[model samples]
Target: MVALNMTVDSQTGERAVRFNIDALVIAGWAGRNREAMEHHIAELEALGIARPKATPTFYRVSPSRLNSDPVVQATGENSSGEAELVLIAADGDLFVALGSDHTDRKVEAYGVTVSKQMCDKPVADRVWPFSEVADHWDSLILRSYVIEDGERVLYQEGSVDGLLDPRDLIKRYTGTDTLADGTAMFCGTLPAIGGVRSFTTFEAEVEDPKLSRTISFRYDIAILEDVG
Candidate 1:
């Protein structure tokens, strides 16, 4: 079991909580807008990745890959990060956080599930109660930045409108509206700003315009040579 030392951004105040996660699900091809989702699929196909057999596919990964640190290591530079909203179910309560579904593009062509498990998934330490943002959920936005030539560039920016509603996504995954206990799901991501590319430092965040709050995190990438 992977224990995440997370913080609850409750209305009262921020409180510490240790969430022991046993299952980590990454939802792919989950854009609510079929047009936008197809744009992403075609984008990947341009790079030799085949389309998913079905939309909103759920890929199961080891819970241990969920990481909270500010530094992540990749075997090479053939990987990039995608901004995503994260859902966590713990102690009978559901909370929402921001995360990056950093993936190995090279491995993805052959096997996406294996590629997902190849890198550490970075998530913010703080989260908000699902109830707090549930009402104005569509007003929320997901964005990401990539460091290129020592300049931070907007890699992706979009409203959650492009993605599936949290409830709908959860139902599709577990045959229910609520997530099982200790489950953390990466809800899916927006397409890239310019195009999909690798970076040395990747940052991601989620903004709730209604609540006037945001949760974010960044990680430096360490590229190690592949030993064969």
Candidate 2:
């Protein structure tokens, strides 16, 4: 396991603090066999093996039990490229995990959403349908960092502005929407030594010369630590 030191900067310089993270062990049983894992997973309609009532008795394998494999190819182009691959277990089950590398620090999970502007007309007021118009608007990125000791929560919030680089691919992918006037938003939360959780919201916009209006966009992020 690796310990991380997070730093915050002020007009003067930088201040740093150490965070202690205990190594977590996750264990879980795969499907009956490697070939049956997917079939059983599909039959159970479960995402991964986290569902409680799912069949095939899947379990969460610990980090120590995780096998090291070669890096997979990147998924989408731009700042937010991702890779998906399978982990083969000698015992007969297949474990799946997704890898997203967007910064110097390692991230366990993330989410993204995109939305567009709304339009009003004499006939009817409507918003851009993402399925119909698929281009427009800018993206916003939200990220999470583990805060240890809870020394400067309020001060850290003010310092978050400088922690991110807008041009990074990971930032772009997670923040941009595919649809026009699309509003993209992402929220990520990292617990004191647990898996990171993320959520996204998207909106679409409609364009028309007759009734054009400016849209207001906003983004908010919240982080909570010490979750078991």
Cα-based RMSD of candidate 2: 23.1
Candidate 1 versus truth, CA RMSD in Å, comes to: 0.8
> Where in model 1 is the C-alpha error above 4 Å?
none
Worst 10 residues of 2 by lDDT: 114-123
> Judged by lDDT against the true structure, how good is candidate 1?
0.91
| C-alpha lDDT of all candidate models, in order | 0.91, 0.21
Provide the TM-score for each candidate, comma-separated.
0.98, 0.17
Q: What would the per-residue lDDT of candidate 2 be over residues 1-228, giving only the tens digit for each residue?
A: 223233322224445533222222111112223343344234223222233343222122222211112221221221121111111111222111111212111111121111000000000111222221112212212222322254212100111122222122223333442211111111111111122222121111112222243111111212223234
Best by lDDT: 1
lDDT per residue (tens digit) for residues 5-110 in model 1: 9899977889999989999999999999999999999889877888999989999999899988889889988989998999999989999988889899999998
